[model samples]
Target chain A: MDNYPYAEQTDNELVRLSLSDPNQFLYLSKRYEDKLLRYITRISKFSRDEAEDVLQEVFIKTYYNLNGFDPDLKFSSWIYRIAHNETISAIRKKVARPTVSLDSEDLKNFTDSFDLSRDLDKSFDRKLINQALSKLDDKYHEVLVLRFLDEKDYVEIADILKKPVSTVGNLILRGKKLFKEEYNKLIINKNTK
Target chain B: MKNKNISQIVLERIKGEKIKPISRRIFYIKKVLFWTVVTLSLIIGSFIFSLILSGLFNNDWDLYDRFGFNFIMKTLPYFWLGSFLIFTILGEYYYRKTLLGHRLRYVIVIGFYMISTIIFGSIFYFVGIGDVLEKSFIDISPVYRNIILNRINFWSQPEEGLLSGIVTKIGNEEIEVKDSNGLIWSVNINGASNRNQVNLFVDEKIKITGDIIDDSLFVADEFRSW
Candidate 1:
């Protein structure tokens, strides 16, 4: 085995091994956890917390249905599929919950970190960008965020979303348009010197 | 647990306090169970198929001339599978609609039962349960195997039944029976704990109906009566 067990296996073999020896799937998690985590983190409008919860559900579900997958299919695509479903489900559950009460301190602190030039250190355009991202439809938000943040290819996003790769490409085009418009508006208003 | 806005949330929560990552025991058990299931289902499924042959075609079971003979025979694997699946689905549906519905993990947990059934079932079948069919099975003309499998795919199981039959042989986990017309039946009474003991003799008239699926035989949802 290579130092990186996941690095050596193809998605098909990983899934096959996952079926008989599920712990092998732990390799899958090691490989994709950060990537998928970032996916939900980005999709949930940089809400790493909600995204983390969503990621857990995705892994658990994947553990069980890993066999349900057809071997010919790509492993990353299948993992993304679960991520997409779990994210949508988590979002639904959240919408049903009473509004997310922002502790004034957290919001003020989060907002205070939003300065364009100074705060771009990490939470660049932090509060405002995240908030505007939250406003887009989940599908729109998810595609763009996964594309930019997760750096997944079009086929990967299509696999996650269970659409044709061409469909995903179109989604990115549309999502990017909306995202750029909203983003430009945010930067224009805040960064006008 | 932080209720702060989504940004504070990340990929950490997808993990639980305990990382029980499918222990070695479970992994081994899963392999054992899987083979055991495939083996047992093959055996059970073959027996069920013999009965089906008796029911569908009287004596000679000669399927050489049939257009779908190969298709029906190739389906030999799925009957075992369909039987297992149909039973699990029905059992859960029955339990929920009848009495034991409060199980939050009911659906996912039922899947575990399936893995166990497949491993053990395959084991039994592989261990020489139907040696007689070896000639008729392997020697099966490839043309017929595909046809038989195709035929089997079209049939499903009933949810309940008034199947009257006499018990022929009882095993550690299954019940064998002879229907009124002199056909064999393998009634898996493994999960029927709440029901009355179904003992079949040479002429014990009986009818039974429940969602019983055998991953090795066929879908039980189509098993309304037998």
Candidate 2:
């Protein structure tokens, strides 16, 4: 994956480049941006316009403060902090705005499996994943996002959320429980149909 | 509603847009300034510690004798440069209410530094060009190697009839030799020193020719009892 562009260099080497060569910090950006956007999008429940805008702000912050980054913490943890704050901000903005959609289709788009296969020539549809993600709470949703989508380890999740490893673990367990409960609700409805 | 399908769809939508680039110039300037301040503060702290130690302990201690100090000095400039670079590129992740995000910057910097050093060090070591590497954790200095290799030059001794007329002082694998003209030379007594080396004791005048290593010690290859 493009996630680790400088695979030969250790995270430390990349960090040096980030601090000394700001442009090099793009390694971090390229690696994290997609996953971060997904995470924010999931957390913020923003439509395309809102999520994209929030993502831009997050990146701007990441790039600007790139030098201040210490390599001691996992890169993902730092990025998550930005994403988390950005998502919160976006959510606040949505709360303030008058535009609201009651229907799930109007609130966000779903992947049209048939259309995606025909047009994008891709096998997977992201909209379905987002729905399932939305069904989970901040705790479970975020942990799942970090673990599967973002591919960050538990330690990194703990660090990103500023919780202890055990706390992060507990969140993951409870989150999974909640997600299972919610996932069953959606699936049961789909089966009835 | 399958979990796998949901994950795939979520990933795609997240990948939906290109993240906007931040203003590079403004961001980097601030980055450099911030890191410069951090490095300088660290150096200032270390310098103070060093000063305190100098005043308190052995004032006559040579500065370069410490390995940790050397490490700090070597990497200090890189820290400043790296900070400057980061300041110019990303600007601010966010200022207020985003202290966690701000702290994350340090994490990234440190992570990169560690990973890079190991990669570079390993590459340099395996490629057989480590000898030319500018910075290293491995002791690449030749003096240490040479001392361990050609280590026979530490004492003076008498062995054969050849050591005649040379007085020998012996102690701990070392011997001091004085010839008829009273010229003293210290040489090492080593069995593995070299082929045909000599050994001797006190009051035994030995005639021998010795080689000096940097005028510090001597190695005797030939000796005769006087």
Candidate 3:
């Protein structure tokens, strides 16, 4: 894996270069490829290959619509928005029930966000947290994933989802509360069983 | 396949397939189009709002006392009001299509739209554009006059002592008027009150309230320009 000589360039600068020479788009797409793949896998039931297919489509569409990118917005948000829409469309086409697939790092991020004790048995807590997240509505689950796991702020989440910042704030607050309640309910059910 | 470089693959696919970025002009045109629709909607909404104001201001409020709430309801500019609402919604929709338009809440957008239309509409109203538009619409569509301005139909009842028409001839104490229904009536305005502040002239539309002396004669107690 060679070091990208243009890695230091700003996204806007890269976008400008990409517009002039299609090869410059390599750096831009490479920058978002891993992140978008993880996002697609997190929000949908696609396998890694399927998620990569979606990511490839996202890159192609993003390149095709490069002229439409508003310079006022962060390139990451714009690309993520494209990735999000493509993943959702793919999910709809596949008719697969969408679910969150949290890995170890994502679980740690989620638990750390809520200040849950790290001392707890990791596997059990991971299962409980994943079940709680799965139980949430798509709106709540998406926001929680973006805010806690992806580490996006309210404004970025709002831009990615094309919702109002205030709505994003409210969703995060309500999502956290709902997640805790669901986690507790799951724990109680597990204890009884 | 799992170990393949996706970006490289996508880049090669791009090179092979000859996919090009859509022209910036298309996006520019789309953005301009959305803004154009929004501006046109706002302008049209302001005009419609101005017409609404004109309708309300030009209405005979004194007749409201005699005719009651039904007269007020019948004379309201529902057509203009409906048009204003449609333009307002269209303005909001197109505004949302603009870049960063989604950042604001619907209430904020709608509130801003309402305030803009009100301010500009009032300006249009005070400048008399509203009246001109109303008159033009009336001229263009008789249905508009008959349906929206039912006041015309209400005033055309000669048997009920309410009459309106264009003045065709003037006499020492009488004016020959042609009503909307094409019936000519000789109106005696010798002692009629002009508290309504109407200027009498040939070809002026006038409304009268009084007794019907005969099929072609009406003695008015009050007369006002319509």
Candidate 4:
């Protein structure tokens, strides 16, 4: 795999190459496979197999729409946008509620992002955080996941969601405040119980 | 599932299924089509705006005292106003379909659309397109002249002491005018004030505020060229 060429090429260059040779798309898909798979699982209720199936579709769609890719936008944002749409569509078709399935690393990233690292030391607090996130509105939950776990900038999130940048900024701000309120509510309920 | 390569699998499916990227020309055409709709909406919206201005400006504001507020209501261009609003909304919708269009907020897009319409509409009005368009519509469509331009019907009521028509003949102190309904009335202009300050000539369209002396005669108190 190390001997394979084109690993160092930028996404945009890979896209151009893939347009001429369909096999070159493998490099582009490989680059985004893990990231998009994780994104799909985090933002949806899909099992690992289902998430992988969705990721495969995302890659296929990305290749099928390669001619329509806008040069002005980053390829990463474009691919993420496709992944987000596909996951949401799959969830809708199955009539399943979207749930955030953050791994240990994602949980740590979320806590560190909000300066709640001390709370992460307790295993119970991690469950509470997960429950709180699952309880949030889909709008707030998606933005929080993109901003904190995925570590995307406001502009990138806006591009991925196809929303105005200012709107994305306001959503992130409001999402953080809502997340704190939900987390605190969960802690109080657990103590009372 | 643990060792399977998703990329290789997808690539194999693409090869087997013969899937190809949609042509770049299709996307380009779609973008161009959306922009064309946006442009047409803006232009049509501006023309409708100009027609609205023409209707308002050419309205008989001096008769407000006689006809009261109802006259103002009756003369307003509600049809053009409605059309302008429809086109404005359409312009915003199609503009959003363009690339990078969602980057701007609704307020910004609508505000820009309104400003462009006003600027262009004002230019169209000053260039006399509004008046010409209005006349053409009135000539071609009786529904427009009678219903939409209710001002004409409002003034053609001779028995109610308001009348308008084209001058067919001029006498010493009376003019024979053919009303919108094809009835000719002898308008006695002996003591009538010419508010428009224009000389009355044959085939000139005029509005008269006066009284009905008889079935065929109307004594004018005031008159103006339309």
User: Considering every candidate listed, which one attains the maximal lDDT?
Assistant: 4
- For model 3, how does the per-residue alpha-carbon lDDT over A1-193 read when each residue is reduced to its tens digit? 3269697899999999999999999998888777788888889989998998999999999999999999988899899899889999999999987788888888878888876664333344777888888889989989988898889988888889998888889989899889888887888888899
Q: What are the C-alpha RMSDs, in order, of all predicted structures?
A: 18.8, 18.8, 2.5, 2.7
lDDT of 2 by residue, A60-84 (tens): 6665566556566766677787788
Model 3, position B105: C-alpha lDDT score: 84
Instruction: Name the TM-score of candidate 3.
Output: 0.93
TM-score of chain A of 1: 0.71
Using TM-score, give the best candidate's number.
3
Q: What range of 10 consecutive residues in model 2 chain A has the weakest lDDT sum?
A: A98-107
Q: Model 4 segments beyond 4 Å from truth? A: A1-4, A117-124, B1-3, B157-160, B212-217
TM-score of 1: 0.38
Q: What would the per-residue lDDT of candidate 4 be over residues A1-193, giving only the tens digit for each residue?
A: 4235798898899999999999999888888787888899888988999999899899889999999899788899899999999999999998888888777888789988987655434344677888888888988889999999889998888888888788888888898888888888887788799
What is the C-alpha lDDT profile of model 4 across B1-226, one tens digit per residue?
Answer: 2425898999999999999999999989998899999999999998998999999999988878977988888778888998899999999999987767777788899999999999999999999999999999988998897778877878888888999999999998999999988999999999899997969899998999999999889999999988
**Candidate 2: which stretches are off by over 4 Å?**
A1-7, A96-133, A190-193, B1-226
Which wins on lDDT, candidate 1 or candidate 2? 1
Q: How many clashing pairs in candidate 2?
A: 72
DockQ of 3: 0.62
Candidate 1 vs candidate 4, DockQ winner: 4
lDDT, residue A69, candidate 4: 94
Q: How accurate locally is residue A57 in candidate 3, as Cα lDDT from 0 to 100?
A: 96
Q: CA lDDT of B59 in candidate 2?
A: 21
Q: How accurate is candidate 4 locally (lDDT)?
A: 0.88
